[model samples]
Target: MSKTLVLMRHGKSSWKDNLPDDERLLKKRAYKDIEHVASAFKHCLDKDFVFKSSYAERAESTAKHFLKQLGIPETHLHIESDLYTFDESSLKAFLYTVDDSLDNLMLFGHNPAFTNLANALGDQYFDNLPTSGLVMMHFKNSSWKDLASGKTILHLFPKNLR
Candidate 1:
């Protein structure tokens, strides 16, 4: 069975509050970016998809905004603390834990990990996955544990969309 994975980097965060890294809130521009991407991405969503996000405030907020823009209920979002890391290996390990029964998984989290994962699993090479960026890849494998190089079907970034 083929699998689809959509990786989204959290929106641009605000540093004005001098808050902890995980507590930083999103910038006003982030909302606009999320709205732009979500509107264009709605049609591409799988009928049955799981949307998960990191526990960080920015990531959680980004996921919520996407669901709101797409009209998906908040109950559909899952908060996974393990996704808060910046390491790609940790992200891959978390992916391996996802049940094989699901064909599509969408994740919203921090960068470096997301960018690294995309470069590793996708056919395309991206210098960086900008804030509010989303990439969709289709894997020909049946399980998340076996996920490998996949065809990068869509790559959306705020700057490009504007």
Candidate 2:
């Protein structure tokens, strides 16, 4: 079966004097952009999506808001600390952990890993993946374990919407 991987970069975050990097929430533009992206992506969403995100507050907030706007169920949402990586290797490794029963996977993470992942596993190249950015890659492989570079079905970022 074909599989889809939607890689999302967390929205712009608010920097606080006392808050740790991992604890920072979404800023105003992040919220608006995330909402816009979610709304635009809603038409393509399927029930098969297995959503996952980095454990950071910004990533979680982005995923939650996207889910809420899309009316997606929280059943398959996986908030993983292991997903918080600076490179695509960890993200690829994490994808290997997914069950084969699911065909569509949505991943929320950070950059430059996200940008790297898109170029590495997609048919296109992007210099940067801006806040609330999303890349939907289509793999012909039947199993996530066998995932390889696939075609870029969709490439979106906050700046694109503006």
Candidate 3:
């Protein structure tokens, strides 16, 4: 069975200047971008699709906007505190733990790491995955444990929808 992976960077987040990084929220522009991107890919999502986000408010709210726009049930979403770390090693650790039962996994998190993860898992290389950027790929392996470089099926940037 082919596994599908959707790696999306959280929408542009606000800087309260004094607020903690984990409490930062999404900007108005990010909401618009999330709507556009989520709507563009809604049809491909299945009931088994799982939306996972970082514990950070920005990432969590980004996933929330995506679910609201896509009309996907909240039951499919998960908030993992470890995702906030933003490292390839942590990303890999998380991926390895995913059950093979769910083939479609959507990850909402920060850039650099998200950008790095996609490049590591797909043939396409992205220098930067912009705010609200989305990268969808398919793995030939049957299990997430076997996931490696796969086909880069789609790339969506928020600017494309603007």
Candidate 4:
């Protein structure tokens, strides 16, 4: 069986100095972008897909909006602390640990690491994965352990959605 992975960076977040990094929330514009992106995946969501999100507030907020748009229960989403920062290796390891029963999965996380992981798996490089950017990849095999560098099926960013 083949598996599909969709990676997305959290939406734009407020940069208020008073707020701690982990407590920062998404801006209004970010909410709009999240809605748009989630709309694009309505079909898949209807079919039931697995979702994983970083524990940080911004990422979790983005995931919440996506779940609402998809009409998926919050119970289906996993909040992972390791995805909160630049930890591509840890992200990769987590990917490898996903249940084989899940064929379609989405990961909501931060930048640089998400972008790097996308590049590493797809065999290409992206200048940057903008806020609310999303990349969808399909693997020939079902096992995440078999994933390697440069095996992507598609890449989509918010800038391109306009």
Candidate 5:
């Protein structure tokens, strides 16, 4: 069976407040973008994927908004504190640890991790993965441990979606 991985960058976050980076919430435009992207992207997915989000407030909020817009249950979302990093190697290591039984894994977090990971593990090159951007890579390998390069099947950005 083929394995699929979807990497999503969190929506634009509010910087008006002096709050810590991890505590920052999504801006109004972010919510709009997330909704639009999620609604359009949801149609391309299969029902049995595992969804995970970084523990950061902005990322978690983005994940929740996406789930709401996609009509996916909140029960399907997992908050991973380790995913908050901006390093692609950390993200790749995390992917390697995912259960082999799960064929599809979706991650919501920050970048240049997402952008770098897409370039390292995908056939298509990405200059940047903007806020609310998503990239899906399909691999022939059944195990996440053996996941390396794969075909970039879907790449969606909020600006392009609109």
Candidate 6:
């Protein structure tokens, strides 16, 4: 079975200390970027995608916006706190727990880690996953456990769409 993975970085967050890290919401521009990327994904919604997002407000808000715009049911969405700042190994462990029934999966998380994880599973080198950037990758196998670098088919970012 073929598998598609959509990896997105969280939108820009308010840096004010008044709000906790987890409570920081997306900035206005970030929301705009999210909408742009979500609109792009709408063309591919027929792929039957499942979404997994970090529990942080920015990430969750980004995921919610995508769900709302893409008309994806909330039941197919998961909020995982573990994905907040995890490394490739941690992301691999999380992917291991995903149900095999899901064919196309989207992950909304933070940068550096998300960028690294995407690079680790696909032969793409992104200096940084900019705010609200989205990357789509295709793997030959059905299972996430078997994913590795050099298997990517496509990659895109919000700025690219601009």
Residue 62 in candidate 2, Cα distance off native in Å: 0.3
Alpha carbon lDDT at 97, candidate 6:
76
Instruction: Tell me model 3's lDDT, rounded to 2 decimals.
Output: 0.88
Give me the runs in candidate 2 sitting further than 4 Å from their true place: none
Candidate 6, after superposition: displacement of residue 74 in Å?
3.3
Residue 113's C-alpha lDDT in candidate 6? 79
Per-candidate clashes come to 0, 0, 0, 3, 0, 1
Kindly give the stretch of ten consecutive residues in candidate 2 with the minimal lDDT sum. Answer: 39-48
Residue pairs that clash (backbone atoms under 3 angstroms), model 4:
121-150, 122-150, 123-150
- Candidate with top TM-score is 1
The TM-score that candidate 1 achieves is 0.98
Q: Please, what are the lDDT tens digits per residue for candidate 4 over residues 1-162?
A: 887888889999999867988889899899888887877766555445678899989999999888888777888889988778777898888888888888888899987889888888876578887888888777788688888743676666666666
Query: After TM-score superposition, what is the CA distance of residue 136 in candidate 4 from its true location, in Å?
Result: 0.5
Better of 2 and 5 by TM-score: 5
Residue-by-residue lDDT tens digits, candidate 3, 76-120: 788998788778878988999999988889898987788899989
Error of model 4, residue 139, in angstroms: 0.5
Q: C-alpha displacement of 29 in model 2, angstroms?
A: 1.2
How well does candidate 5 match the true structure in TM-score terms?
0.97
Whichever of 4 and 6 has more TM-score, that candidate is: 6
Residue range 74-151, candidate 5, lDDT tens digits: 999999988999999999999889999999889999999999999999999999999999999999998998988899
Query: Compared with the true structure, what per-residue lDDT tens digits does model 6 show for residues 1-162?
Result: 878888888888889768988889888888778888888767777787878899999999988887887777777888887888748778878877777778899999987778888888777777888888888888887787777653665555678776
Q: How far out, in Å, is residue 48 in model 2? A: 1.9
What TM-score goes with each of the models?
Answer: 0.98, 0.94, 0.95, 0.89, 0.97, 0.90
Each model's lDDT comes to 0.95, 0.88, 0.88, 0.82, 0.92, 0.81
lDDT of 2 by residue, 6-67 (tens): 99999999886679878988888888899889977887775468889999999998999889
Which run of 10 residues does model 5 get worst, by summed lDDT?
39-48
Q: If candidate 4 were superposed on the true structure by all CA atoms, what would the RMSD be?
A: 1.9
Model 3 misplaced regions, further than 4 Å: none
